[model samples]
Target chain A: MHVFYQPDNKKHFLETDEAHHCIKVLRARPGDELVVTDGRGGVSKGTIVSINPKRVEYQVRDFYQVPLPDYRIHMAICPTRKAERNEWMVEKMTELGVHKIQFVISEHTHRETMKRVLNPERLIRVALSAMKQSQQFHLPEFAYFLNLDTYLGQVEAKERYIAYVASEDIPRHLIQQLSPVRPVEILIGPEGDFSTAEIEAAQAADFKPVSLGDTRLRTETAAVVACHSAVLAQIQ
Target chain B: MHVFYQPDNKKHFLETDEAHHCIKVLRARPGDELVVTDGRGGVSKGTIVSINPKRVEYQVRDFYQVPLPDYRIHMAICPTRKAERNEWMVEKMTELGVHKIQFVISEHTHRETMKRVLNPERLIRVALSAMKQSQQFHLPEFAYFLNLDTYLGQVEAKERYIAYVASEDIPRHLIQQLSPVRPVEILIGPEGDFSTAEIEAAQAADFKPVSLGDTRLRTETAAVVACHSAVLAQIQ
Candidate 1:
């Protein structure tokens, strides 16, 4: 069954874009059944009651609640030089069940790249698509921080980590440092990585320095891996 | 320092494409230093002796052997419908330190997609770029299997898994089933998962059915997660 995102569970209609996608793109007609998620763990089965290019009305047939993950994962990552990589990270992180994503502007993130201004609407569309593709009920919230310090000052989680590449001697791994019971957050820097001061500041904020694994990963890859590690740590 | 892939560490010169990149793109001068990898375990530091667009000659200053991972990972995955997604998978898998990738055609893989063969050379380039990007001395080999059975019959590993999504009740996860001391192989299907017969055949071949995690992941994401799980499992 096709899944639609309609944040208002009480409403019998989908938003304009989603409605257009249903009526025009998918050719969804009256009486067609579909699933709708409020993106807050509420899922409902609905039958299309009326459909138009601008509006899609549905009748709720069943309602259910999906439980949120016991642990919360918030990734504060500097967007890569490439826009698509950032978008890809958002999609995969959403699929892997991260609770929130805050795009950070780190010392090493090129100022010119930041000037491009990652469109929030585009990122939201990517996240929404991934949430639907993965059949997930919850959509991860997205935020942007002007700099790493802003993120460091604002975020709170029981377990905090910063993914930094250290010298040959291994630091503590992310999985090794993860607390399955506590809400967790990880800081992933840009391609050039965190400067010494940024790293020190994060450490001062109680964000333990951790390695994702032995291999060197790009900014986007590290974000996805860190998110998955957080998700896997909760399995037990 | 820029890293280059020269499979023959004994050679004094890099191959055509890399030579062009070093000389024409980066405009390296004589006496510049670079790191070269043989894509097995050999790593070398070299000083440029001469530079040309098509041939870059270097004098080896030091040679060292990087130890192979204690465990091996082989991923057999069906190519996603999107060609870029497949390329992205190859790049990420290589960066994550997967040993080999075998593209297989499954029962549900669209015939049209399989007809448009995945370009081996392009995939190799991606792996090589990733190996250098990740600053690793090893490159993952790529192979194509006509069908799932062909892959099942040829590959051998100590731990085998098929990443199949089952019902709501959680199944055994990949990390939980991994053996850090053993070589591992995992099969990830396309958007359309493995057929019942294919899963049965894999089971007969001693491939344990495993879940990567609770959330639904795209084929590429699942493959990367499985590879990382295998890599992480060896950490102990």
Candidate 2:
């Protein structure tokens, strides 16, 4: 079944983007089966009733609910200087079932201040596209860019970690310390990494230091790896 | 120490791109020390000898060999329609220490045949840049695009897996079945996923079916997740 996004199906119609896609792009007509989501947990199985210019109307036949993931993975990371890389991370994280993304400005981040222009709408678009493509019922929440201090103060989860490059003396990789199926938050640093003071503060804030591996990963890669690793641990 | 790529460094000189970056961009002088790699296993600690228009000469003071990863991760994945996504995977797989990438033309793959245009050079450039940025000594190999049958026939590894979207009866996650520190080859399907015949054929060839997660992932996202999972399993 082709999954379409219609945040509100109360009127039994596809959203504007879905309408455009069904009518013009996909040529979906009456009697075609469609699986549509409200971008929450509501999934409806329906057949197109009409292909109107304004909206493709559908008759709901059935509905199913997909519960949220067993463990919530909230990932906050420093945005890279390259916007595409950050966007790519958002898309991949959505596919991997991340719950939330908060753009953090650590001491070593690319722009280092509020002066940088960040298009939150673009990130939202990327997340929505990825959620639909992955057949996921819910979209991950995207928070606007904020400083590390603000993010640290506001974030809440059962377990928190900061993924860092592991040197020889670094005792445990993230995999070694994980407790399965719990709400967790992971922080990924910029290319220059978290400064000593930042690390110390994170430590004080109850975030344990976890290592991804010996190889130095890019900010986005680290974020995705951390996300997947956390999910994999849940499965274990 | 800044890491630069001089794939050959044969004449005691940086490659043109590296030379320009080292001298023009980085402004290195005669006495400055530099760590450079030949994109193979050879890493050199050197001191600048001369600055010329075409190249920067450096005298090698010491050489260090970077052994390849304990477990070689040869990832064969179907390429997506978007070129940037494919390029992003190449860069990321490089950072994560994937040894090789083979673009397979799977049954469900988009542009399954001759219509697809793939640039191996662009991927190689991505790998080189990632290798330097990650401060890794070796560059991953980028293979030309090939058909799945040919890939199945030619690949030699101690272990093999095919990452698939799991349904109700899916038996195992990849992490559960892995033996530490063994070279492995993994295959990731396209956005449409592997055809039943393709999956059966792979199983016939002894490639274990593994699930990345419950949520469906994109071609590039699955590829990266598979690469990282294989590495993580090896870390076990």
Candidate 3:
């Protein structure tokens, strides 16, 4: 049985696209056993009742509910110009586990990104694929369409930090500062780094600036490191 | 002037390609100050002596000695078919700091990689670029061209770990297991993962199996996690 994602299945039916994949690509037929997830930590083992080119109906044989992790990640990163890297970030973080992602549009964000809009659909697709790949069911929500003020306004975290390279201040490394607290948000800047003014503003906004480590990491690498650090901090 | 890599500089002259970047791209002139690194913990600041189409001659003004971290990373990873990700592994690990990389051609290693030989120069080039990008001054040695017996025969590590997923025999997370010990080697397998026989052989050879958190990470992600964990564990 192949695994597929069907986030909402109150009707217990696979959509046309997924039905097409099951029937045509996977050669699935009626009475075949299938496993699917609802991306909200709900996985079900089902037997197909009927199938057509457009849809497949199934009856749930059993369901497994996964409890959410004790901690949540609210990773806010400025979009890099290379959408692929941003997609990679989404995929990897979703695999590692995250609750939400906010695309921070900053003044120093790559000029190349300014030429085009960030695609939320593509990020969702990447997230879904990674979720399936890692055998995780939770899909981290995107907060990209929101502006900085609205995004910050919506974040209700127990801990908040902004990752940036500090000069004389010498920000503490992220791992050193983590306390395994629930609901954490960490801001990662772009290639040129967050401007001094942006850092000050974030500081005023109560974002504690932290460094991932001694090495200067790329934006995507920093995001993943921060995400993993938060996850590890909560584990033990 | 712009920074460039000249790996073999015993003759004290930049090669044609680097010279082109220096003279043509950067328009560096005689008597101009320039920074170049030998990629082996040697960073030298020099003054241009002369330039030609073939090479740019420089006299070393000063040399910066980067102390090899009190630790070393002996990362042996099964190469994935996607060479881009392998290049990415080289770049990210180099940025984060590692002493060496070994390509373990294992039984479950992707068959596609077996068809094409590992490219050491390309890996080094990516490493050099990452070194400069991260402002590091050391290049990690590669052991892909060597036979496994000869490679493992030279093991001088204080600690050894094999990163893999286990079901019955629980494995400690890599971070929880690291002790800041010097000369640690961690093996990461391919997508198919190491076989039970291979695991047993490693266990017989004194390799402790370890997990990198709860997520089922990609081969590259696992290797990077192992690399970063080793580095962070070493940092006081």
Q: Give the number of the best model, judged by lDDT.
A: 1
Looking at candidate 1 chain A, the ten consecutive residues that score lowest on lDDT are A110-119
Q: Which candidate would rank higher by lDDT, 1 or 3? A: 1
lDDT of 3 at B216: 80
The TM-score of candidate 3 is: 0.91
Winner on TM-score between 1 and 3 is 1
State which candidate has the highest TM-score.
1
* lDDT (Cα, tens digit) per residue for candidate 1, span A95-136: 899999988888877667765757788999999999998889
Scored by CA lDDT, what does every candidate get? 0.85, 0.82, 0.79
lDDT (Cα, tens digit) per residue for candidate 2, span B36-84: 8888989999899888777788899998788886778899988888777
lDDT of model 1 at position A89: 90
> Which residue pairs in candidate 2 have backbone atoms (N, alpha carbon, C) closer than 3 angstroms, thus clashing?
none
What would the C-alpha RMSD of candidate 3 be, to one decimal place? 2.8
TM-score of each: 0.95, 0.94, 0.91
lDDT of 3 by residue, A100-209 (tens): 98887787764356336478877898888788777787889887644555566666885889987655788888888888757888989887887787888777788888
Candidate 1 clash pair list: none
- Tens digits of lDDT, candidate 3, B1-236: 24677886565789867788788878888998888888877778888899988799999878876788777888988887777888888888888888889887777664456446357778877887788777777788887743334445566785888987654767888788887757898888777887787777776677888878777888888888788888778654
Report per-candidate TM-score of chain A alone: 0.93, 0.93, 0.90
lDDT of 2 at A6: 79
- List, for all models, the DockQ compared with the true complex: 0.79, 0.83, 0.62
